[model samples]
Target: LAKTTQPISMDSYEGQEVNITCSHNNIATNDYITWYQQFPSQGPRFIIQGYKTKVTNEVASLFIPADRKSSTLSLPRVSLSDTAVYYCLVVRYNQGGKLIFGQGTELSVKP
Candidate 1:
């Protein structure tokens, strides 16, 4: 399994855009980038997944550069409720229960 690294924390203001980047230098060519977000008292949840280009949802957008060594999770016009810890994971398509979790990035959205 590859290790996904993130910053200890980040800060943003309400209505501001927040971009959190993660690095996966050892990620396999077949691996996919999975972005997860967590609330203050809840388990981390999958936010988005992508191999290249961009994937966007109502809540967030994921950008995977061509090189695939890193990815950025973008939250547009973030609100106070968007404050949470985010994680980026490099995972095999169907290798269940094999992923390892590292310290994630804690994003603080201030009012």
Candidate 2:
């Protein structure tokens, strides 16, 4: 299993761009990088995922370097409602693997 590390907390103002990065130095070849966001008392919601390159969705973008050791989740122009705890996960799908969640980075979006 690849151990992932991320910031403990982050702060940003409303309508500002926020980028949270995760480092997985021992990531495996078959492992795919995924990110999730959770509000207080709510389950984590999927934000984005990437294999090797950049992947962009309507809400956020995921950028992975060539080495696949790290990935970044970028939220464009975040609002006050975006304040939540963000989780970074490394998983191998189709293998019945359990999802292990680490202490996520708490993002505080202030107005």
Candidate 3:
């Protein structure tokens, strides 16, 4: 699998919805799309995961295109407390659950 490309930063007002998208044009057959949320000074928290179509959970929704080349993570009505960095990762077994943190997309929620 290849590396993912995502935005460097995004800004949203409080109570607004935010969507972050990433592209992995060289994604492999065994790769899965996973989203993680991280606040400053803390580890990334698993937000959602999907291999195809849509997967929704309590915190977010992950929409993966059929080609498995890209994915979008949707956060509904984000608040100031939701300000954090969001990461899109290509899940690979060889990674040993060790995340390779890229320059994550910084999500800023303004009051």
Candidate 4:
């Protein structure tokens, strides 16, 4: 399993763009990068996923460097309601298609 590192917390204001990064130094060739957002009680909601380069959805954008060792999740024009815990996941297909989650980055979106 590839270990991931992320900031413990982050702060952002309303209408601002926020970027939370995660590092995976020992990533393998077959690993895919995924990101999820979790609220206080609700289950994690899928944000985006990418193997390389950039992948964007209506919710957020995910950027993966060419080295494939790190990724960044970008949220544009955030609002107070966007405050949540974001997770960086490493998905390995051969390993029973399991999703390995790490300590998430807590984002506080202020007004």
Candidate 5:
């Protein structure tokens, strides 16, 4: 797994959109970029994944630049409930389908 770097914290008022970016300079060929969202007490929930270009789901949109060295997670119309820690993990297919975790970005949704 490749180590990723992301912002420690971000402040956003309720109903505003928030974008969290991550950088992974040495990602392996087999590694896939995956994003997760974590509220204070609960475990992270899968937000999105991408190998190239863009991928979007109900929760967020992932934008991977041409270099693939960094990516962005875009949260639209965020609200107080959207306040959570965002994690970016470089995951590769592994035995038993297990994946590793990297320190994530903590997003504070203000009211």
Candidate 6:
């Protein structure tokens, strides 16, 4: 299994975009990348996910390069309410692996 890695913290101003990068150097072929955002009291919510290239939705976009060793989660025009902890998770296609928490990037959106 590839070791998931993310920055401890990041800073951004309101109305600006924030991109958080996660690195999985030993990512397997069947692995998938997913991101989740968590507020103070609520559980983490899904942001975006991708296997390769790009995946976009109403709230966020996920970018995976050809190597698949790393991924970028892009949130557009963030607000103060967007300040939260973002988690990057790796899931296997058929292999039921345990999902680990605590390794996530904390994004602080300032006004």
Best prediction by TM-score: 2
Better of 2 and 4 by lDDT: 2
Error of 1 at 82 (Å): 0.7
**TM-score list, all predictions:** 0.93, 0.97, 0.93, 0.96, 0.92, 0.94
lDDT score, residue 1, model 2?
A: 68
Clashing pairs in 5: none
List candidate 2 segments past 4 Å from native. Answer: none
TM-score of 1: 0.93
Q: What TM-score should be assigned to candidate 5?
A: 0.92
lDDT of 6: 0.89
Off by over 4 Å in 1: none
**Candidate number with the higher TM-score (1 or 6):** 6
Residue 59's lDDT within candidate 3 is 85
Choose 2 or 4, whichever is better by TM-score: 2
User: What local lDDT does model 2 show for residue 49?
Assistant: 85
lDDT of 5 by residue, 67-110 (tens): 88999999998998988888998887753435666667788888
RMSD (CA, Å), each prediction = 1.2, 0.8, 1.3, 0.9, 1.4, 1.2
Which candidate tops lDDT? 2
lDDT of 6 at 93: 56
Candidate lDDT scores, in order, read 0.87, 0.93, 0.87, 0.92, 0.86, 0.89
Error of 1 at 8 (Å): 0.8
Model 6: which residue pairs collide?
Answer: none
Tell me the lDDT of candidate 3: 0.87
